[model samples]
Target: MSQAPASGSIPDSTALETGASEPGARRPYLTRTRMAAVLGALTLVLIVVCAAAVMFGSVPVDFTRAIADRTSPDHAILFAARMPRVLMGAVVGAILAAVGAALQALVRNPLAEGGTLGISSGAAFGAILAIVLTYRFGGGSAIVPAAGFAAALISTLAVYRLGQMHGRVEPFTLLLVGVIFNTFWSALILLINSLVNLYQTRSILFWLVGSLEAPTYGEVAAVSALGAAGFVWLGWHARDMNLLSLGDEPAHDLGVDVDGARRAIFIATSLMIGGAVSVSGMIGFVGLIVPHILRLAFGADHRLLLPASFLGGAAFLVAADLAARVAIAPAEIPVGVITALCGGPFFIYLLRREGHRGIAV
Candidate 1:
């Protein structure tokens, strides 16, 4: 009855449907090929940065000799001090950044981070508690991390519960509740410090400010194992995260168990944060800054964003640690101080940007 459509022409019904969706559709800038290129580039940069971290510390050491000849004069410094610290930095940084990206998606809040959620404070409190107990009663170093992990999980779950209302989590409400919990834990840490001796107080202060000064090989291995496990788990759920970002109703309609996905992501992020804070103390901003930068460069696709964030974060902290080592030359600044210096301004910018949008989630 009707003439056939011309070759290369879409049918009228198809054309109409496509036009109807055009206004709401978003085109991604990073294609599969482009994402691969960017990831490869970031990985190369990470490798170069890791080498530099080992080579350029407070002391001058020949990079080639440090790697080639263990008998070289710098061998002890390279292996005993710098290598473990650098590896710790890499592990902690990657965990923070990857978890940050996942949490941001889960909460639908760009400002979400471990420190903001009180997870770091809770971990620090637990570690400090273990330190005090060990100092008085005597125990292995393992007690601190174990306590920290338990405390971090408890605090995160508490926050998660506080943030929910009528089975929904409002992003702004969650942020506010997290801030309150952080303040409460911070004050409690100070109170505990007051009760301890001078040496313990000093150690607690160092942990609070954060450092990568003296990580043992065993601590490095433990954190690496935990971090790798968390990364893989989060990566497996990356598709669900992408779907969740499209809004709850749409995600639910598409067969995502919204509440279950949220809970899983929350637990996964807490585990990553706990493992890191247990080892490195409260290193903030790496999580907040690394994920944000990568999201801008790539897109909000978690599959790519999560891995990219890990690599980028590893490189970033390694470089930051290197700067912390040499910036004072024989006296080191806390790595946290350097990250805060960078993150503080960025935080202000985020607030201002949100203000322009009327602070809507």
Candidate 2:
């Protein structure tokens, strides 16, 4: 006869297999010195990409002239058009990626993402609603973003509630509800578009597909502020996230407030996702791609993972946006198209790899 395990002692298989006491759990793979170097490299790459973006618009821009004279036409195009769009792309990408990393850690699901939670779909619906209302009945400038944020929060709360079973949120249930919500909201958006005029319909379609075109300074500033706050909050809770990843019971035993941490991170991610969707439209896969790649490169230590996701996400989206601009020369494809093209294949690959394990992290 085998003896029962002690009440508080973690079993070896349970602890090690579930990421509670894995190798390198005591210390992350990327040290501070290495992280700093990586960040510096990513930043340098971002700067170079931004410069290229500014220089390669539909109309030719002289970089030398733009730098020399801010008053010149080339400078006007660079500062007024390209700079804001590029900055918005970076901000949106960082927020999405960081939020993705946090959500994945929170639920212990590799496939968990903002879209998987219905936040993006809700946000898109809200944005579309705002556009329709603005066209039908004039509203203030803040209506679109405010509506989007509100809808996102509501949808996330609904998912949270629906995912709860006996006081615990189940990852698969949440994902299922999210899929339903996304389908519903997408149909609603299409229905609304059908009722609207041609111009409004075009606008809604463009936003739904996503774009980094003609972003204004005000929009960029708002997204940056919100994204910064979200990033800081997520980073501060990174260690807590690591604890939560080892299943809820183990996390509680480790002194982590599992519920509180999940709630806080959910809200933070919602803010970031809503802000990005409101500004940049419905760009997908940034969150999915960035976090997974970083996890494969560096171990799943949120302290390093979250920040690396931010930097890598910023660089990735900037590069994608650049491709969107130059791929068709005078005519530009939406950045969302490019991301989907990249993310779709990778997503399939992940599905196949995780299929046996049911895609749970």
Candidate 3:
């Protein structure tokens, strides 16, 4: 094992991109000031992407014309439908991405993602159950998020416990445990689907794949607030996550209450994941794709990566959702399909890259 860097010493950025024998290994750690600058640039990028996504859907909305004519279809379409969808996409994307970055830190596994922990699957199952119960009995849309959050927290706790090896989480063991949970939860979702009517099946499919079709302002607001809380809560643990990257023993040596911190991180993750999946369905890879890309460019520092991942993820999903809209024209594809298509090969590449040796967190 590589020796832990001494107290207060910055670990070499080398092993990360710090591949030995590569000239690029000498790259400097990303400073907070620089990270602030990057966040500014990322914000700009997000705004531009949002504008583009809003402008170029299946039926283009002319904001100028809509502004001049208040009663135009463009006005309703732009404000009522498209804007909410875009905002929801941004909101959910940010939630998933930011959570993914923090999650990787929690597990000290770079390959760790939202789905890797089974939170997404657990959330999906909860949402599905809510849908089924609503139709069978009688309820409102509110039950869905509640059910999803409950299921996600329970499933995640199960995985956390199952992943432990002698009281500590083994990164690979936790990942496998999550996969098993995902399969179990997914099977339940399928069983429910088989028993449901076609309408419910369509709903189940939406939760299974994912869509940003039409979200209400209320849903958007609720999700945004929850996501913001998750972000700040995780950010509060940034230094601990950084220490954890060094290894469990080293982080403990540095005074991080590893078990306590991990528990808190998992709870926050469950909240956001349940909320995001509740609104957006199983939007697979926003977490995997966004954080990994940002980590590559920004180094694995969660302080920067968390927020940057949020912005970058918002931009990425808005753009992807736009593509899903246009990719078939009039006929839309599930946003998850677009992400899965992109993330599948990316996942394979990551598995292969990290297959030889574990990432240092």
Report the number of the highest-lDDT candidate: 3
Candidate 3 residues lying further than 4 Å off, grouped into runs, are: 1-27
**Lowest-scoring 10 consecutive residues by lDDT in candidate 1?**
21-30
CA RMSD per model (angstroms): 4.6, 5.9, 4.6
In angstroms, the error of model 2 at 325 is: 0.4
How far residue 137's Cα lies from its native spot in candidate 1, in Å, is: 2.8
TM-score of each: 0.89, 0.87, 0.90
Listed per model in order, the count of residue pairs whose N, CA or C atoms clash below 3 Å is 0, 0, 1
In model 2, how many backbone clashes occur? 0
**lDDT (Cα, tens digit) per residue for candidate 2, span 200-266:** 8877877678888888999999989999998999988999989888878889999988878878897
Clashing pairs in 1: none
Lowest lDDT block of 10, candidate 2: 21-30
In Å, residue 99's CA in model 2 sits off its true spot by 0.9
TM-score ranking, high to low = 3, 1, 2
Q: After superposition, how far is residue 87 of candidate 3 from its true place, in Å?
A: 0.5
Give the better candidate number (2 or 3) by lDDT: 3
